[model samples]
Target chain A: MNLLEWLPFIVLIPLISSGIVACLPGRFWPWAFTLLAALASAVIAALVLPEAMGSELSYPFGNWQPPIGIEYRVDAANAFVALLVAGMAALALPWAKASVDQEIPERQGAFYALFLMALAGLLGITLSGDAFNIFVFLEISSLATYAIIAHGRDRRALLAAFRYLIMGTVGATFLLIGIAFLYMMTGTLNLADMAERLPEVSDTRAVRAGLAFIIVGLGLKLALLPLHLWLPNAYTYAPHFVTVFLAGTATKVALYVMLRFIFTVFSPDYSFVVLPLSSVLMVLAVAGMFAGSWVAMFQDNIKRMLAYSSVAQVGYMVLGVSLVSAIGLTAAFLHLFNHALMKTALFMAVGCLAYRAGSLKIQSLQGCGREMPWTMTAFALAGLSIIGVPTTAGFISKWYLILAAVEAQSWWLVGLIVITSMMAVYYIWRVIEAAWMTERPEGATRLKEAPLSLLIPTWVLVALNFYFGIDTRLTVGASSAAAEALLGVPTGGLP
Target chain B: MTDNGILRIIARFLIPFIMLFGLYIQFHGEYSPGGGFQAGIVVAAGWILFALIYGLKAGLEVIPEKAMYWLAAAGALIYALTGVASVLLGGRYLDFYAFEAFFNTPQAAQQFGIITVEFGVGLTVATVVMLIYTFFVRRKSEWDEVMRGSDAE
Candidate 1:
């Protein structure tokens, strides 16, 4: 009846179709079904985006009211995120068709089913308003993710999936415990209700313990440094398409949850001020930014390099959050969206290379620029965005982040941000040099360009990276509204 | 020396009753604590016991792989589509109040929706458990074949 009514369908359409698709016969049916599901979900999300930005949209299941039954709430922040997610899924499906066919030997249908399930779970997380329900959906996505990663043909993929499972379960367990503590303190599982009740009991040891546990749990999921060991291997060993989707969406959704919990469930004053968390977060963010970039430079595997770079990108986002101001939060949300575009494009381009060359090594890309002109060019352009080049999406995010640091009067953070962007330049140059500078091997056969199916999706994202870089209306508008909502002012002076 | 007499007789006698009890639990859940989840596991236990007594091939003949996949998918679909159906009827997603037009009263509609979704859940759970058991058991035959090959060599 209303746009808010359609929120559940955004998740259910994909969840139901995943099952139906699994039962369908034929090798192509799964991919076709996935594409249709993603497209439908994306369209629904677009229609709902305006409503979500205006006010919170909550749907209580089975006619039950909030604080008693589960609710699906969408605000400017998560709704924008949901749109980005659906858009990415729709774009990734076409590329997935070619990549999965090339990489996997059997069970294509099941793999597609898992992909849809994971999509549904991510959407569920973004839309859910219940604290415990978040855990339910988190596990759904995590379990499906483990299976998808294990679907990679590499023998090491199994190990990677197993390791992820172990770490992910521990994180989920801690999260569940945190939710339990909050429920104990507040006598409710609904996030809004908890936020209302938590203030009265904010000074208690139990509440503080709950906050500590929750942040630590999400920190693991965010892959903050020292807790980030499982990421590089998992990304490196997963199937190209699986890696692309997870790289773009999984941690970003986790970050959204962190944002929601810190700003909505627990008041910023309690979490950021009372606990002195900004200083701790600032230290971790700075360490992660440098360490992630430095290690990425030495990686021989292209996928591994990108995975480490993801760590660095995550640091920039956290650094923004650590500032605890409207501008700071805006920078964080903007970079989250920008990084998704850049990483998705980069990975899709790498998938194209892998399809033709059969390896993801830096060495394998030698002279690939000459052979696959469209894909290599896409990579180079997206690479510019990654390095914060002028007139690119990456540059826009770094610019805002620096501005936020300036607002906070932290010149050192400004300096660190610039230094990391420079480091990004060096590592990205390695790929460019390998693709453009090195001559084609003497005895090698001529490699054809990637199929149009793959090339189309890669370039669409690449085009958007530059387009949004210059025209910042949508990204800036959505992020600023979301940031103001989180901070409760145009420019918060909490710190 | 009917070596298999006890096993066959025991399986034939126990399987039907176990399945019947599972169905009883599945439908009786509304008045009691047990529901589709417990019932589904019980029903699957019946099939698993039969497979253990007989063999993998015979077990598959009873419920083939394709049928198992369809059953799993169909069960989940039944549960989800009921919620979707409510939305299409102009109610909130998964709200049984949408069914009030078809039923005698709102409470009746709620009852109908709950029962239907529970049935769907039971179907999915039972099918999935049976499917998993079948696959895990089938791997034994392959392992045996590999071991036999080594011995012959």
Candidate 2:
């Protein structure tokens, strides 16, 4: 069979396994099965990525032709994101057995089942070529996410999950309404077909409203500032492993969907030039950066602080998107990948700390630098990456964003980027200071290093952060190719 | 409610017909307005009526909580497996025409595949609905006991 033939299984394997996992009797068996399923799906995504980078791979469900039946279309952009999501799932699973055992001991089968369902949903969202199919997958993932979040031991976890559900449902509704408008106008759900038909009706108010709705709806999902209230609490309160998985993948997938809609379906020309969305996005992005970073600085809980930092990082990606250039899109995609690496590693490190300390408060981590050296060092390194220090994955993304801004001749935006990087420095410094400078509390129980099961995945991601930071071949090459594919140009100009 | 003779008698008489109608809806869905979702709800409604009249314990005796969970998973598994089977038979996922060799005609194969898929959907929907109903009907004290037990762990 051709490489494209295996594309559906990237989604199907986890989807099928989730059902099986749900029925499995024992905790160990369910977890073992989920890990194997995640590994299989990741391998398929890896196999398909090389082919997808060179050319689009389309698979029609039920052997039905497109513009009619749903299709799974893989190109450089989505294929890269799919690999990140699937790869993260694989990486996170090995860490999960230890974390889930400690954090949520009941209904382990259900927990693993939901985890796989969420993974399948995210992958499905990345692969789907139909607008409606994306919505279906979005709900599938969102519903599973809410349930998983509610599994946190704290009562606040339930409240956080409920808030997310309400906000997420509203966002999904807006998205569905937007899709309905577009379908009414274009008479097709297939993204490529819609793009072809959209030009004639692009000037219509309904189409414009549809565009606005799509942006706001996806904005919520991606936790764009002002719409990001659901994120910090949800991240802070969810089971530790869940926080790691979601921090790495969920918002990044949402951003990829937004990119697909804005660039592929709506056309950059229509979205940027005709609509004047670029400036609005620029303003929002910059505001998000400052607000997110500013709020992150004051947070006492390490998880909540990182959650806010994610909002800031999201702003950087959006700022890249606002430039509407090939280089800019590359920067956005690059940050999307790099952020996943650093954030997942950071969260895993936090999970390790939580595993040992049983708390996420920064004070709880005092002297952890001496006690859990491996875990704290991993955190510090990932923290350095998030601060956009040189020779880290985070630095490469910021470099590109600066490059994109300079190309657009927006010098003030460059200053803002640097300022946010400094803000990142201070917040990270607080944790580093507490971990390294403060002495262990007198009479405190001795804390051991996190078990290798968790540390290995954390360090692997930290290693990737540095590797991608220096190598730049895979990250830069794939992102530029993805940018070119999205823009339909050899360079930065609109098609 | 269980002490009400009229309600119990009527529920017993109506449930079989309600279930039979649900099956009819399930089979006739391709050409009509109702399909798995509607049929599943209808069939589940009959069981719910039985539970409401006969008591939750009696309903548990009939279907059991554990069986409901298994059935829910089984239903989804059946649906996904149908798609996987088509892929194995050299067709794209969920392509009913993959079964043409066995069914002797494309239309027949398509019908067979749709029916099987819908049946899976129906089974899952029914069990899940019943499960939700049971949970709602279950006492809050019982739920608290379960929660307290887990928390104690």
Candidate 3:
């Protein structure tokens, strides 16, 4: 009847349109169709502010309360993710032009159609309340993403997709097993109800087993340390557009689920007792941070370097969660949002270079700042953000994280964070130096700038870095609220 | 290229009902075990049955490769758009409680919303199955043709 009530339809619209479009003529203008659907979906998602900013809405499936019918719950946390995924897809329309034109073929419509479905799945994963619903969307997105990745021009893309499929399937199966274990214990799938029920039998082995399965399974998807093998290649060989979309939304959304389960569903107090979970997570995060950056320094291809860097960045976010402090949670959440912007901007720059030079090799990018000034400048700005330079969005999260680590008396972690960030700075500066200082080959001169379409979205993220840096109100505030919410601290008074 | 095999005829006749049954599973999900994902697989199986009996080429002729891709998007879009429509109707994100237009009662509205999304999932899965089959068959046939020509030479 009203805007707040139609939340499910936002997810449903692109979902159904993806299906209908798939059945339509692929020769038809898929870009137009997919774009319109993404835009419309964004509009609808934007309309649901009351749910996102206000409070949680629980829609009882089949008119039955939880423990009976499936439920789709929306609160401040996931609703923003719903908006981000849809908005990114919408903004991707113009950016998708040059990249897709270069990477995909005349059968681009099919790719676009699949792209939309994957978007729907990602959004559904972010928005849905039912645990099973998450698994469904996860499969939908994974299957579609694999197909999309396989459509890439290189043979490596297919291999990469296959590898991802294997790993992703294993992760999914584990998550399913975890859900099954939980279901067997509680006989309910509603997340809220599970949160309530979990505390009663928090000591049960089934619950512990389920927690382990979920942590490991999600760890794989989140690319947390030991389970991160599938990430770099998938990002590198897949279409450039895909790197942007997945980097911006997919992992962060997965992190959201992890936080949701750990804090809200499983009761963090119980789950952490067995493993000294925070310490374990911290070790992994530290490893990811250092190892990812170290690997990035050795890579010649800028795209692959960014991919490794993403792993490292993910570690920082995970580290934030590991601290078990509200400030650390805020830092992690804020960084997840900020990192997506930084990484997306950085990847777009690489994509633009890939478009013109037919390569994203650091050597080939030598003196590109002189040729495609706009694109490379955006690259440098994003790189600075990634390096956590002051006055950029990236610095805000690192600043808080260092503070959190200090507060936790983990002064060693504070040093680790700073040193790893310096590693990011080193690798990033290597690219910047090559792009700006090294001599451009004779033929490489006279390069045209990326089209306004691509440049605009790239700059939007770049601008966001500066904008959010100066005004940490939204990022910091919401993250604090989210962190407090995760801690079960009742953020009512937290200003 | 066999013409009008008995099995093909039987498959053609039964596939639609199977798909309908898949739709029923999707809608009845709240009260049952199967919902969007399972229903999707089932409906996709119907397309698989059609593709196998009539052959991928024949199935392509009927559904078309490009059309199948769009159908996948349409399916997810249906799911997304339905949620958005609910939002426009004043429901929270994925909240189906206010969808009185589709379901007269609050209980029915919730059921209606979930089913609507389930149907969207079915559409996506069905089309994905169809598209994947088309590609596999095309690739296989192309490989086969190349092999035959090489052998003849």
* Candidate with the larger lDDT of 1 and 2: 2
Q: Could you report the DockQ of all the candidates, in the order they appear? A: 0.81, 0.90, 0.30
Give me the runs in candidate 2 sitting further than 4 Å from their true place.
Answer: A492-495, B141-153
| Candidates ranked by TM-score | 2, 1, 3
Worst 10 residues of 3 chain A by lDDT: A19-28
Candidate with top DockQ is 2
**Deviation (Å) of A378 in candidate 1:** 1.0
Best of the two (1, 3) by lDDT: 1
Q: What is the interface RMSD of each candidate, in Å?
A: 0.9, 0.5, 5.5
Error of 3 at B85 (Å): 9.2
Question: How much of the true contact map at the interface does candidate 2 reproduce, as a fraction?
Answer: 0.97
Q: Write the per-residue lDDT of candidate 2 for residues A1-495, one digit (tens) a residue.
A: 887889999999999999999988767999999999999999999888888875889999999999889999999899999999999999899889899998877788889999999999999999999999999999999999999999988889999999999999999999999999999999999999999999999999999999899989999999998999999999999999999999999999999999999999989989999998999888889999999999999999999999999999999999999999888999999999999999999999999998998877888778889999999999999999999889999999999999999989999999999999999999989999999999987877788999998899899999999999999988988898888778877763322
TM-score of each: 0.97, 0.97, 0.86
Which regions of candidate 3 deviate over 4 angstroms? Answer: A23-28, A43-51, A61-63, A442-446, A491-495, B1-134, B148-153
RMSD, each candidate, Å?
2.0, 2.4, 4.5
Supply every candidate's count of residue pairs whose N, Cα or C atoms clash at under 3 angstroms: 0, 0, 81
Second chain TM-score, each model: 0.92, 0.91, 0.78
Cα lDDT, model 3, residue B106: 78
